[model samples]
Target: MTATKIAIVGVGKIARDQHIPSITRNGAFELSATVSRHSGVDGVENFATIEELLAGRPDVGAVALCMPPQARFDAAWTAIKAGRHVLLEKPPGATVAEVEALIAAARDEGVALFATWHSRYAASVPAAKAWLAKRQVQSARITWKEDVRRWHPGQEWIWQPGGLGVFDPGINALSILTEILPQPVRVTAAELQFPDGRDAPIAAQLQFAGASGETVSADFDWRQTGPQTWNIEIETNDGQLKLSSGGAEMTIDGKVMMQEADSEYDGIYARFAQLVAETSIDVDLAPLVHVADAFMLGRRIVVDAFEM
Candidate 1:
């Protein structure tokens, strides 16, 4: 079988640690070239900008944009306009409004566009979603806390304006929450706590109201110390369901139900190949929309100055 050629943009932290390894393991894709301002992988062709990459590597069938959310839409639109399928990293674009523009462009060009949610492909996520589909939900809670210094060392964009600080990690939980919930949910209340010297919040608390009359509360913080926690608990009529370690494991009332290894980025590549073959698009912006809504409508506060 022939492999679909893909170009990697940004080539930053996530692209190197996750996307590169996943692309190497997936047989359906070929790493054609890269676009990055500072660094590029050895042997592969490189360009300093997305425009240059697309112009130089005309054979690239698709481009996976691993840049920050702020720079997503223009790269996506450029690739899609050039007849190349576009793949977007999570929190797709800066504003929900820009992604809508990309969607319109993708449709008019008759090409594929994928806004990837790597967390949805987490080890136990499908199982949890299926299990919940058969049960009656009561209420849900999500807690994600981690030390920013350890997880994102030396990264500064996360604290800048239009950057997503705590929501950067918290959006993963939202992906899973939106996927497993049987009914649509709307944010009822939200509170964001920003560091004194930062433009983005370092902590957030959110409340959601579901069509099934269930309430979900989410707390995300980047100040955790020991035993960093990323857990989501759902209280249902049947029992309590818990997904911990960022959906790597699931338990029902403390009884282990299912667990598996994660190949989220690999799954993303495989799906991208399928979309390329079908000449279709799969871009789910619900999770991102919620984040934007939180930014636009949620209450905000400034706290102590955050470092690292």
Candidate 2:
């Protein structure tokens, strides 16, 4: 069988670190081309813009957009119009509304569209979800704190409007939360702290209410200093369940449950390959919608200025 012809747009850090490597390692998809203003892969064809790439390379069957959330919609639209299946990196677009538009467009055009949340594919995450599904939930708390200077380095788009500062990482936790919860949860209140010089919030405290009347709290901060932490704890009738190291490991009470090494990006590529073969679309926007709601409805606070 012929491999699925795939091209990548916005060949920046994420595309290089995750998508490109996964695509190259996976057998089902062919890395046909790439579009970037300042970067290109070795030997693969390169174009200055996605429009130029689509116009010049009609054989490209799918396009993976690894751009900042603010610029994702236009690139996705262009690719869809060019009759290429589209795979969007997390937090799909500038707004949940724009993702809705993309869904409509992809359906009308009869091409697959996938909004990938890499974190949801963490090894222990599926086990946690299965465990939760069989038990009764009482309450939950998520504490995700990271050293932004170390993780982001000089990434400037993370601090801009629609860039999703802390929420960029926080959304990963939410994707897992929404997936494991037996019932749906809604944000009841949120407090966002914006850096003095930035348009986006650097940290957020979110309170959520589940359908079973369980209260959940999440604290997301990007200003953590040393010894970063990313943990989610849930109390159920059976016992306490916890996922630490960004869902790489699981535990209960004080006992080690299951330790899983990270391979979320690989899982994303595998899923995308399956979707391409089935000619199916799998785009879920609940996490993005919760983010938009937080942005639209949450109160904002000004915090210390953050550099880089």
Candidate 3:
């Protein structure tokens, strides 16, 4: 089969580090073009905007939108209207309603649409999910803390409304949780800590309840200065299962079961290829819905201003 000609929008750090490399390496896709206001990929056609890229590269069959959540809806809508398949980064849109709209548009246009959660494709996530399938979950705790300056330095949009702040990374944990657990969960209460001058929260505490009566708690903070942590621990009827390093490693009862390097974007591209071929849409909105629910029902607290 001929490879799908794909274009990338938003040539930021993720597009350069992950999306470009993954698409170039995947046999099912060919990197045909890029659209960015500032950065450009070498050896590929580049355009100043999505409009120009779409008009210039008629052969492109799909697009991977690596832009921020706030700007995703417009580009996605334009692409779907142009009858191109779309692959969206996590937290598909700034609002749940926008993603819902995109879903309808993609369906109406009869094109593939995938909202990728890279962490769900981590090396050990499936293993954790399989292990928990037969066991009873008692409780779960998720701690995702990192230094935003190190990860997203000088990205002012992160502090603005719709930037999602710490939830940007926290959603990764929720994605994994939603995937690995045997039953669905919902946010019951949330406490968000916003910086003095920021519109988004820098830290958050959330409580969740599973359909089977399991309890879950999440703590997301972007203020850590020392060792970074991305971990999820769950107590099951059999033993304790811990997924650390953002689902890259797994342990049961203090015994290491799995550990490997991450290939999240590679898996993302692979899944996108399958979706495009099948002409199907694979978008799980549970994680984003939980986020919206948190914002809607969460209590607000003022915290110290954060500086990068």
Best of the candidates, TM-score: 3
Q: Which stretches of candidate 3 lie over 4 Å from their true place?
A: none
Model 2, 300: alpha-carbon shift in Å? 1.2
RMSD of each: 1.1, 1.1, 0.8
Candidate 3, clashing residue pairs?
none
- Candidate models: Cα lDDT each: 0.89, 0.90, 0.94
lDDT of candidate 1 at residue 205, scale 0 to 100: 97
Give the winner by lDDT.
3
Q: How are the candidates ranked when ordered by lDDT, highest leading? A: 3, 2, 1
Per-residue alpha-carbon lDDT of candidate 1 for residues 1-308, written as tens digits (9 for 90 to 100): 88888889998889999999999898888998999989998989999988898788888888889988877878888888888888899888888889889989998999988888998988888889888899989899999999988878898988887679999999999998988888878888899999997899999999999877999999999999989888999999999899999898999999998887888888888898888888887888889878887887789998999788
Clashing residue pairs, backbone N/CA/C < 3 A, model 2: none
What TM-score would you give candidate 1 relative to the actual structure? 0.97
Q: What lDDT does candidate 3 reach at residue 169?
A: 95
- How much lDDT does candidate 3 score? 0.94
Candidate 1 off by > 4 Å: none
